[model samples]
Target: MPDRVYLDWNATTPLRPESRAAMTAAFDLVGNPSSVHAEGRQARRVIEEARESIARVLGAAPRNVVFTSGGTEANVLALSPGLRAPAGPVERLLVSAVEHASVLAGGQFDRKELSTIPVTPSGVVDLERLRAMLAGGPPALVSVMAANNETGALQPISQVAEQVRQAGGILHVDAIQAFGKIPFNVSELGVNLATVSAHKIGGPKGVGALMLGAGIEGPAALLRGGGQERGRRAGTENVSGIAGFGAAVKAAMAALDADLARVGSLRDRLEAGLRQTTGVVVFSSDAPRLPNTTLFAAPGMKAETAVIGFDLAGIAVSSGSACSSGKVQPSHVLEAMGASSALAQGAVRLSLGWSTGPEDVDRCLEAWRKLSLSLLKRSGETELERF
Candidate 1:
């Protein structure tokens, strides 16, 4: 078998060496963080240091960061709605139509009245529609992702936060895919809560954080346990994972400029290679997007078939969102962009990351050229690549 090309960074990133080393070093310690013994104190020190590192990258105070099981848990905790705080009047949940399934399935509010802000054809949130929804009387909680996982379309989160504030609402931005790849400052976004995952940033999986800004409403406990995460989320902290996460965050920041430059160039080259052939369309091409993701479709090509073909060719890609894999459903993100079911079914996403290089994208394009030719033949279209 040939070496596989991994272009599905939106699903998860490979563990970086720094994160691996941190986790290994943490494993040498033998104390519970909650204990008062010397061993416990050492463990606590590691945790606190990791907390500070993560807080620094997010431009948040260390005290305000709450570590959770992962991004899913972080989002679920962030969406908890209650009038526990003195801020007053908390009643609704507004989620962008393109949020991850975790946010959609978090059960933060009554499912009956959950409001969805529509997106334009370009896969951007319809601000006018959002403003109209905000005009109503219920106190709202708005959840918008920093970027779409499939299309890489960047959301106007700062603008969304302003709207939420004007409407007396709280905003939560899921920055899982945007954190390491893009420039992010919590102060600039002005959101009440932001969720970021470790694995998405080359840290270990199973650890993530929810950044709570000042004045955000307190969420009811998602898990009831022996009082962890400062009573916000209750569970034994994955101390090693958190340490790895901190290391990954620092490494990502240090490499951000070089990564952004490399990924942008490689992504453009791959997209251009695909476009050179006929019957190819890039989703959200005209909109601002992350440098590393591309969602494209060819006429009469089903995504499942394309995915299998690419996989057999030693390339890995995704049809829609990785979180919704094996569900046999069309992409909600593409449907929100007004793509027909056929077009949506034909779309596949290729996302690059820190480990990606020019050669990786080149390999992907080569495999794509072969697969596209075979797919065209099977669909009875003229062989565009044969020329």
Candidate 2:
């Protein structure tokens, strides 16, 4: 197979060297973190260090971080009605229309008890609508993502936090896509609950955590029969994966400024080139978004076909969020943003990473140029170089 440029960082990132080394070292441990034996103590230390790393970033105590299988699990666990502090049980749930699928499921809450908070046409949460919802309802659990996986639009979390708090509602932020890419701290953002994933920051998959505020009480466990994670999340830990997550967090945070500056510049250049193409549409261009993401579409283009064209051109992109990547459908996010059905169906996402370079951006633009030109010239059909 030929080497291809990777532009799907929002889906998952390549493992960092530091993370790889940490996982490799963790493999030597022969005991479970729950055990009290000598080997177990070492394993426990690894997990503790990982929790501490995440806690440090979230501005919370290590004891407040609960490990889970992945971002989805962590998000689901955050939806419990009792997952609040010094307050009564939550009677309602409010999730942004553009939230991840896991959050949209409403966890333990019934569908009838849940409501969707709309977003602006530019793909931002509608604060006025959210304010009205919070005011009209009982205590609610408000869920929102720090940055969107498809359009990378940054939510006005600080403002949302203030609104939720004023209405005596709890706030949960799915920070998986924004934690390492931008600044995110549970306390700093006035967030009571926040979840993050490992793979999104150059660590292994199947490992994530839910960071809780100090005032939080017993919200109940998603899994049972084990005493792990302070009895809040039951199950043996993914020792090696947690170690890798910690290492990746440290490395990513340490170099965040440099990565932001460089990757952001490449994205700007890539967008500039894409805009040069006639009839191109960039989603959420006017909104504050993650520095490394761009979702674009062309009139009459079919995203599934465009994705294949990019692949044939030795570049990897996606039609939308990774969860919906291969499916032929309109983007729910774009639809919520009030995009035309045609534009929503044809949108394609290209997300950059710390390892992306100027060469990769130029190559992607070349592929986009060829694909867009052909698709437009044919009035909908796609033609590209064959491998």
lDDT tens digits, residues 1-387, model 2?
A: 567899999999999999999999999999988889999999999999999999998899999999999999999888998666335678889999999989999978899999999999989999999999988667889999999999999999999999998888889999999999998888888998899999999999999999888777756788998889999998889999999999999999999999988989999999998887766789999999999999998778878889999999998888862334545667889989998888787889999999898999989888877777777767743443221
lDDT of 2 at 254: 99
TM-score of each: 0.96, 0.96
Local distance difference test scores for all models: 0.86, 0.89
lDDT of 1 by residue, 145-246 (tens): 999999999999889988888887888899999998999888877878899999998999999899998876577778888777788877677889989998
- Clashing residue pairs found in predicted model 1: none
- Against the hidden true structure, what lDDT does model 1 obtain? 0.86
Reference-based TM-score, model 1: 0.96
Best by lDDT, which number?
A: 2
- Any runs in candidate 2 off by more than 4 Å, and if so which? 85-87, 321-327, 380-387
